[model samples]
Target: MVDVVACGELLIDFTPVQQKEKPGSIAFEQNPGGAPANVLAALSRFGKRTSFIGAVGNDVFGRFLQQTLIRLNIGTKGLVLTEEAHTTLAFVHLDETGDRSFHFYRNPGADIMLREQDVNEALIAQAAIFHFGTLSLTHEPARSATWRAVEYAKQHQRLLSFDPNIRASLWEDLEEAKALALKGMAKADIVKLSEEELAFLVGSEDVVEATAWMLGQYDLQAVFVTLGEKGCFYRTRNNFGTVGGFQVTAIDTTGAGDAFVGALLYQLLEVGESMLDIPQATLEDMVRFANAAGALTTTRSGAIPAMPTLSEVKSFMEAAR
Candidate 1:
């Protein structure tokens, strides 16, 4: 049985190495990416029984994505290869400060063609945690497919996790996107968001106030608010803490959030502690480990390419201490 079943987009990101000389110029390097895909890769590398559900184009880029997931040992039985569409591509650009921006080329991309029938009910039933994101909710068939998976997961009483992973450019209807994303969040047992995402959800600029509002309004068991260089803030009913991020000359912030979430999930699964019963020291250790994993990812280039293995994460944490 898979420990985590993640459903959503699986596509290639062509990240540019240099900015354009002019406003409209283009430059890029192929990088396999997608938020859910990156999380699945990270979980698999840490030896979690992970499954990915999505669609890919019957093209060279899709082949690379399939090979990458299989090499990492993630279950890809639910991945559909379609000839009717091309693979989804995100043109990623980084400013001088290493902050990233995106340009999507996703009209009729294979990922958006995911049908309700593409989701595997047996896999969702067997998985301990069913994870999904907001990107798939931006369109028709994919939206139906992802929601169907979520409903099935809920029916089986499985733990649900949601990450908005919002890209404003992808949605023609921003209000609809926000409503749908909030609906997913309400279904989740665990919810994670970046500082910006939290602000958008709560309509507040203060982190503490935003988190407080979430806790007061939602029936969530856990929530994580990632603070980039400041690290992460997390709360469960009985435990709350913030771990300072590791000092690193981050070359790219591409998959850092995914790495952190993946590592956090891996550690939580290993420990299998009741969130309410977790000791302060153990929480600290878990946060430190996750922070190390995330910080290490930024030192490299791609999203999946940058994700550290469990051994690598352990080594980095050991040396840092």
Candidate 2:
């Protein structure tokens, strides 16, 4: 059985590369990206059986992304190619701190063209975890298609993993975005949030309180809040604690959160879902391991390319300790 099946956008990220020949000019490099795709790739890197379900345009960039995912060991059995739309693209810019800002080129891009009919129920039924983000919910048939997957996962008793990787600018109404994110939380068994997203979702500045509120309000099994370099804070029904981060000089913060999510899901798959309500110490250790993966990802560039293998994450953790 597949350990995880992720559904969402599959696109190219055009990240700026500094030029060596030109004094102050730079060029763009196409990198495979999209939160759910990144998560699947990271899980694949960890040797988990993973698959992705999404649509990409029938253009060259779309083909490239599909090929890249397959090469990364992710199952693309449910990948769709639509001729009606071009592939989605995002232009990413990094600040001095390596934090990223995005300007998307997905005006009716193929990712959003996913329809409920395109979602393969057989593929989703084979997974222990079904993961998704709200980015797919921003438009049309893809929105309903994502919701359909959520329903299928719930029906099959598969764990639902939600990461509200919100791109507010994509939403026509910000309130609608928050509402959709909240709806996703209600269905998720495991919810991953960045510090900012957690605050926005819970309407609080307190990280611990936000985690607690989300778990209780949504009656979720567990909530993990990523705190950048400080690592992640996890709250389960019976236990809660902060995982201390591994030290690293981050070159690009892009995809680090996805790496963290992927690592945690991979560990959960390894340990088995029977003990998901882990002891406090066990949860802390798991988050620490995930933190190492996320940290290592930041030390590199791009999304899928930056993901560390299981051995790399383990080695980095061992050296840190």
Each model's TM-score, in the order given? 0.94, 0.98
Off by over 4 Å in 2: none
Q: Please give the lDDT score at residue 37 for candidate 1.
A: 89
Cα lDDT tens digits, model 1, 1-321, are: 889989999999887665566666656789899999898888988989998999999999999999888988888898899887999998887776566888989998889988998898899988988889999999989999999999999999988888998899999977887788889988988888998988887788687777777877878887888888888888876677788888778777888888887888888889887555678778778878888899999888879999999999988877877
lDDT for 29 (candidate 2): 89
Candidates' C-alpha lDDT: 0.86, 0.90
TM-score of 2: 0.98
For model 2, how does the per-residue alpha-carbon lDDT over 1-321 read when each residue is reduced to its tens digit? Answer: 788999999999988788999978979888999999999989999999899999999999999998998898889888999998999999989988888989999888999999999998998999999999999999999999999999999999998999999898899998899999999999999999988887787899798788877876886988888888888888888887788887788778889999999999988888775435567777777889889999999988899899999999999998998
TM-score of 1: 0.94
Backbone clash total, candidate 1: 0
How well does model 2 score by local distance difference test?
A: 0.90
Root-mean-square deviation per candidate: 2.4, 1.0
